[model samples]
Target: MGLEFNDETFRGDYTFRNSAKAIARFPFPFAEDSYMYSVNMEPHLPGRPGSVFEHMFDVDEHYVAEMRDRAQVLAEDPLRCQSLPHMTLAGWDLLELIMESKARDYPQWFSLTKDGNRWHWINRPLQIEQSFTFLDETTLPYGPMEYITRQTQGDFTLQDQRDDNLWIEAGMVTTQADWSLDFDIGMSFHEWHAPVPLAHEMRVFDRALKFLLNLQLGAPVRRFNWTMTVDPLLDTSPENYPKWGPSKTTMTPETIGHRQHLRVELQTLHRLPRSNAIVFPIRCYLIKFEELVTVPKWARRLHRVVRDIPDELATYKGFIRNKPLMLDYLSKYDDGAPTSPGIWPE
Candidate 1:
């Protein structure tokens, strides 16, 4: 069957919701009861059919709406999509990677025809068709990275590997978890990650950087990074904190279940074949506490994880203020049962 896209908004009345299929496949990040900082990297291999990992880039029900939200974000702030002049080639490399992957993985929704440098691309869901010369910027409405990523449902950053380090040079970041692409655009790996607590002292970044610097082509890695958001706000960026931050104060026990959301980012890193730069795509997936509790295992495990998580970690995740309320809501579903190992619902 073809995918059924959802027509919902991420902000302004917050009409977002998850169908049963979406809830079943939500990437709940907690592997065990509690969460911590670790280099929990794994090979980005395909998984069970119908799951998000089944494809190179998972396009879900929210694809169309998310693209609209991205366009709105870009219109409001063009800085959200940027590439250093030297990074244009890397952008083209990223564009080719996404186009080929989507066309191969989802032929019904997307198709690409290539005759040497000339290429014709069609995205059925978005109703966009364009024929442009490969590596030629003038033919496209936007830059290569922006053009592809606008249709893509994730925040992408292109890292240039140099001087035994990965430099954050180019990206299209809109649905971020309290990070600023504009501020961290020119920073090195550690420099941008310096703000993250415990991970730096734990040498997580050091080991991760070393691992990525030697990342082989065709072999990408993925990991999960999660946080808590007051609502289904995709653009939880520092640049617009004032707009969404105040909502955190309005969550009461009566509304906690519907208002609070578990924001999980399925982050994948790939080495671009031509530019030799790593394109990191951080796909944000949000599930409300009420919808997530539908699965007994997830509910029990999430309750324990939130209840037992360290205060510093909770504070850093921007949910410390609502931790008590979350525990109050999630605790009702936790029956002190032991959850099985791994993130899957058993």
Candidate 2:
């Protein structure tokens, strides 16, 4: 049986504080009249003037709550976080990079100190303070990747550039949007994204690998990808399909807006200073459909994109089942009247 869609009040408790600000700062996936997958990479300018490039790692109001979610997910399924043997040093590289970045950005809440090979990290928000050797896993409760992921809000993956390509060397990914880190482990760049439509036909993945390999130490690249979900869930991995799969069939015209949500992944890829591993961090944000139309611009743009989106992309995103209903709900705001049946795709 599918999950029942009740007439429930949508609460965006998991999102960052201030919806207007969140929407304003939101990395809307579509840029122009159409949407397609591509190797969209931008420089890692932390303090850039634009809304998107302002930060590489975001530490926001939901920091505590999000970290708690990650802990719970890891507790239930340890496979949610995995690091291959060779990537151990890369894990340490990521931990130090994240610690330094967070401490520098939020000096009041986060601090890091180094004494020779030993280092201490202080996370005021979580009341956590620990000291560990740079590449020593014994000093921490778990492996370097898992230990670092436990403290941060992003799902991280460390990809090593070798054999003239990038390989999934190690990663600690707890809040996977739809993909599986365990399944993707050891898969090459092209093999990992094999499911994506048009990526290979257009050579997007190969081109992206070349671009990533050439990235300098200080330069990082970022992109946005989006889909719709029925609830605010961080562990929407395929293993938990029984929990969220029923959501699509249960949705109705009345419950669509309140029950359905727009989930977007704000992803950043950077070159690790020491190990030369490419660290990819992904942060997901969820906004209710009912709340989305409140921002007239977002609602209008989303409607246009959904309506114009190709069937292949729509099917891949799981939008085929409920696209018509979502479109009708958005159409109510586009015009005073609901969308006509004729306007909907077959």
Best by lDDT: 1
Q: How would you encode candidate 2's per-residue C-alpha lDDT over 1-346 as one tens digit per residue?
A: 2111122211234333334555555555655535778777666577543354565677655567778777777788888888888898888888888888888877888899999879999988789999888777889988878887898877888899898889986877767777898899999998898999866889888788888889888877788878888766677788778876776899898878767888888888888878888999988777778777776656666787788888988998888888899888887766432322211111
Model 1, 1-346: lDDT tens digits are 4779999999998999999999999998999998898999999998878888999999999999999999999999999999999899999999999999999999999999999999999999999999999999999999899899988999999999889999999999999999999999999999999889888888999999999999999999999999999889999999999999999999999898898999999999999988999999999999999999999999999999998888889999999988888888999999998899998889
Residue 131 miss distance in model 1 (angstroms): 0.3
The parts of candidate 2 lying over 4 Å away from their true place are 1-20, 47-52, 335-346
| TM-score of each model, in listed order | 0.99, 0.88
lDDT of 1: 0.94
